[model samples]
Target: MDIDTESTATSLDENTENFCDNPTRDTIAEGLMGLIKPTVDQLDERVRATRLSQVELRQCIEGLSEELKRISEDQKHSIDLEVYLKKLINAKQRVTVLSNILQSAQERLNRVHMSIDKETVKRKVLLNNTIEDPHSVVLSKNIGSSMSLQTPLYNLNDFPDVYEPSEDTHLFIDALEKDMKYIINSKPTLACEIGCGSGVLIAALAKILKSTCCYFCTDINPKACIATTRTAKMNKVPLECTRMDLTTNLKCKFDIVLFNPPYVLTEELEIFGCGLNRAFAGGLRGRSVTDRLLNNLNDILSDNGVCYLLLLKENNIGEIGEKMGEKGFKIKLVIQRKIPGEHLFVYKFSKA
Candidate 1:
């Protein structure tokens, strides 16, 4: 009885080992079956017509065949193992044929892609060839040319509706709103936005302060002014839009004045070409408008009023603070937000 029990346990262990060692034929067959559909699809589509190299596909098949053949012949195993080995050899051959088909399809696709890329490059070269450098702008002077616009100075193409608010703008607006609340709590009468575009900034101020104070939106570009006015009306905010070229057209002063000037530096003039639109062109060194505005900042800025000016890092508008000191006005940045890739300077100034 003891001998019989020991033999039974040994036999059970061998069976368990065989069961674990055996490969599942169904799993291998399923994997091979998955390749068949994709290969057949490629063949039916005549993907080889596009200049695919059949040589590469042949190489893949040869590799799989070599691997499968070695595994089948070199390994002397049980009948179950031998049967599945034969199936693997067949699947490997099928993979080789599929590789050839896929290679041909890719070669054709490659040719088509090359042709499209070449055409695109040609068109870009032609367009760039026609584009004149900024230095040549002085030579192409015509009185009524597109460059001759006065008040609506910026070309419509200069500013694009990005549809997304930039991180810098978000931070700047938040800071501005906070400062706006401080001012409104103290002297909330009339608020004016200079160089307002799309009405986003002013609309935010309106919503935050929630005051019936008259809001004035002004932009040098007629299109910007009109768009901002429409946005204000849509949002049910009582605001007035006027085409005021900050250099000339603006006449009145307000209790609170907001200026977000186009302060992109000279080094980045590639963005703004010869079209000196009121929205973006900052003159030869990118400080022309900023310099003029700072000089006359006291005019539009009320006697005992607050002014919030958003300036670029390049524009040394901090010099304005020194000038304000001479006029007995106290000016501070109040709230500042440094955006990655660019710097925005916001100052809150009041008469001393």
Candidate 2:
């Protein structure tokens, strides 16, 4: 009975060894592969578009095909221990072969990735240029057309008594050119420049619009009117010269109005005083003449009117804006520039 029990125990041990060997190993290997496949498949997809040279990629694909063929052949002949042993050997070889191919694939994929990165940057630059073309083209064309107005020729003799093209005058014109787009959109019909000395300001605008609109000027001095008319004729712009004191006589509603007023602070007696003094005399902070027109400006301007007024820093622009605001007008502080003695500002006013 002892001998029989020993033999039975040996048989159980052999069966247990058989149960835990190759078949169990294959099951565990398949289970591990099942767990890793999703992540590996994802990585494969990410690199597939730019991995390996065409020739090398094809070779790798063929290698994988051969490996599948070899496995298929081994499965077909798996009717004996020799076949199973060969499959085990082949499986080890497959691991080594796949590892080598995958390493080669990684090296090639890195090179391809670098090339793609370079190409992508170049493509992005091209894309940006193409995108900007549509939006910028119209604006650039408009700017090109607007900027075509060169500085009009000024004869010192024609405007001898009137103020010459001084720094303030040049700055006023520059600011006008800067806001040309807004002025063009406003499309003023009856535009007037009060205190239009030598007609330089009106002529400049007339030339820009090619005399498509009627432009007029007002001055208290008859000699100024003569000088302005002569200056306008020289520039070949049709400008109506009116001898008046700050739009006091005329009740015409103007769409666009410009004034480079007498902004020098002086005593009350010097307000519109003698020869050149009349040109630039402002009593007590240069507000005398400017305030007079501004008080009744709403009636002078049309519904879609815009006024451009030049002032010095001492003129208390904030207070002026507040006063204008109370009279149903809003002010835009357009441009300010400082030179030798004075800080000049150009203010634009429109109905609120």
The candidate scoring highest on lDDT is 2
Model 1 CA deviation exceeding 4 Å by range? 1-165, 267-278
Candidate 1, position 286, lDDT = 50
TM-score of each: 0.49, 0.57
Residue-wise C-alpha lDDT for candidate 1, range 1-352, written one tens digit per residue: 9999999999999998887776786577778989898988888677665335576777889999999998898676645775567455434433433444355346545857987898688667656656745334233244236421111111223235311123334555756655754766766567888777667667777765556577887766666776676667766677888876663665667777777665554323333422223344344345666666667777877787787776665566666667778977788876675543455677787877
After TM-score superposition, what is the CA distance of residue 252 in candidate 1 from its true location, in Å? 2.9
Candidate 2 C-alpha RMSD relative to the actual structure: 34.3
Cα RMSD for candidates in order: 31.4, 34.3
How much is 326 displaced in model 2, in angstroms?
A: 1.0
Candidate 2 lDDT over 1-352, as tens digits, reads 9999999999999988887776878899999999999999998986775565666989999999999999999889756676567455434433433444345346545857986998698677767877988455322334336475555655555444566555567678887888888888778888899988767888878765665688889998777888888888888888788898989888799998989987766655766533455666676667899998898889889999989999988789889988889888989988888765568899999999
Whole-model Cα lDDT of every candidate shown, in order: 0.62, 0.77
Model 2 TM-score on a 0 to 1 scale: 0.57
